[model samples]
Target: MPANRAFVLNSRPSRETPAGPHNFRYVESDIGEPGDGQVLVRHHYLSLDPYMRGRMNDAKSYAQPQPLGEVMVGGTVGEVVASRNPRFAVGDHVVGSGGWQLYSLSDGRGLRKIEGGTPMQAWLGPVGMPGVTAWYGVNKIIAPQAGETVVVSAATGAVGSVVGQLAKLAGAKAVGIAGGAAKCEFAVKELGYDICVDHSDADFGDRLKAALPDGINGIFENVGGKPFEQAMLWLNPFARIALCGLVASGYDGTPTPLPDVRVLLNTRSRMEGFIVSDHMALWPQALGELAGHVAAGRIRWRETVAQGLEAAPQAFFAMLKGGNFGKQLVKLVE
Candidate 1:
């Protein structure tokens, strides 16, 4: 039997921001065989996300803290090599909360068997959590009308990219805000956004204003801080803002200060924050539409894959720093 490689949370960060390699320690262990109702899964891909940063802390949050000495929590798509459970068979593909490890044993709770023409990795990306997240924010929250303008921060990321495309599908003009010139180009050219403003530019506010001349009717906000503050300046009357994430404050585990409430009051705008899991009733509808768009080549996605289980720690840190483009995942096995 081969040993299972797992990245465990060895130490908690002393500060709120900047998670470093010292926080995680990789270890090899013998997981043995699955129990009577369990399945042995070998991870093929692990999803790295901004939310995991919050889990690393001991502070209270929507989700429980990641336990020290346990495998770092994450979503994984993998193959069932052995199964004692009747629900899952050997060689079946599954997506679940498998954590950061080469192998995991599951009793089938929260595990979903996936089989499709789409690549398995897509189950962890655009057609998975990120896609559904974008759908909920755009369709349920923002609800932009045709000919309206919608601005999305972190435009090149998994969620933001999908938000832009969904806005276009709704007949709205999509404007994106990204950190660099290359990412801005990708958002506009590849993702079909009407315009993309580089947040790192000296005149980013001016550029965003120019791109949205009619004022922003909707905003799918992912990155907060200065970018979010700038977007608030262009809100039209009765505008909608879906607050998805604050990646700017994610690293430090700091609370993102709310932008001036006066703007919301003056514009009669609606801004709401959401957790995608809270809307589980809509998953089937969201996934079906996202899958259709992906299969028909209507929705475009990109990935920054790091090979092997050992690479999970560095990959996670890199993702937090915005080093990866699009969806960031760790390829645990071939």
Candidate 2:
């Protein structure tokens, strides 16, 4: 039997990204066969996100942090190559927390079977984790209504793009804030956001105010930094903020402190931070509805795929720096 080649995090990363010995190691090791109640998966695509940055540190969080020298954690779409479980069979298409590796051994917990006949990459984007993040945050959390105004940071990302569209479907005016003009343009033209503001603009705060004359009813808060601080001033009474990933603060060398909580209190609004892991039971319902929207031409998505496992680390860092156009995925194999 051939061994699986895996990308394992070598050490705790610094803000500038630890280089050489401080970063990652690729090693060839035995790909263990499935034991009873387990399945052997050949990973096809891996989803990369800023949240994984937190997992690298030895700190407490919503989930157990990844230990040093373990396979770096991530989500992947894989084919069941060998199964020791009655619930799965050979060639089954499933999604799991398979990490940055060519193969994974799972005991069937936290595994989701993908159907709907859509392209597999869609599962890594709109029909998968990112999509669910967008849907539940907007519909269930934010609860935007017709005539309301919804704003989203990281507007061109997998979750933000879906967030903007789902807001529109609920009859609200959707506004997007992205890094540059090109991304802002895509948010407006491709994603159907009512207004897309460029966060990189010199007068971005002023521009956002101009685009949204009315106060915002809901905010899909993904990137938490300057943009989040600025958006805070524009929220209306009873505004709901679905605080997802803090991509901006997560990458900074020094920790970034949030603005005053008095602002949230003054506006009579609520901000809730969540991990999708907590909402696992709602995922099937979310994915089913999101895929139906995609099939019906209501929600759409895009992806930037790096061709191989070797490119995973680079692609991940690029995504952190706002280099990816849409959902960032690494093609691990096949």
- Per-model tally of clashing residue pairs: 2, 0
Task: List candidate 1 stretches off by more than 4 Å.
Answer: 16-18
Q: After superposition, how far is residue 75 of candidate 1 from its true place, in Å?
A: 0.6
Write down the lDDT that model 1 would get. Answer: 0.91
TM per prediction: 0.97, 0.95
Candidate 2: clashing pairs of residues:
none
Predicted candidate 2 versus true structure: per-residue lDDT over 247-297, tens digit per residue: 887644457677887878899999888878788789889988999999989
Estimate, for each residue in 18-62, the C-alpha lDDT of model 1 and write its tens digit. Answer: 578789998999988999999999989999999988788888877
Best by lDDT: 1
Residue 252, model 2, lDDT: 43
lDDT of 2: 0.87
Instruction: Report per-prediction Cα RMSD to one decimal.
Output: 1.3, 1.9
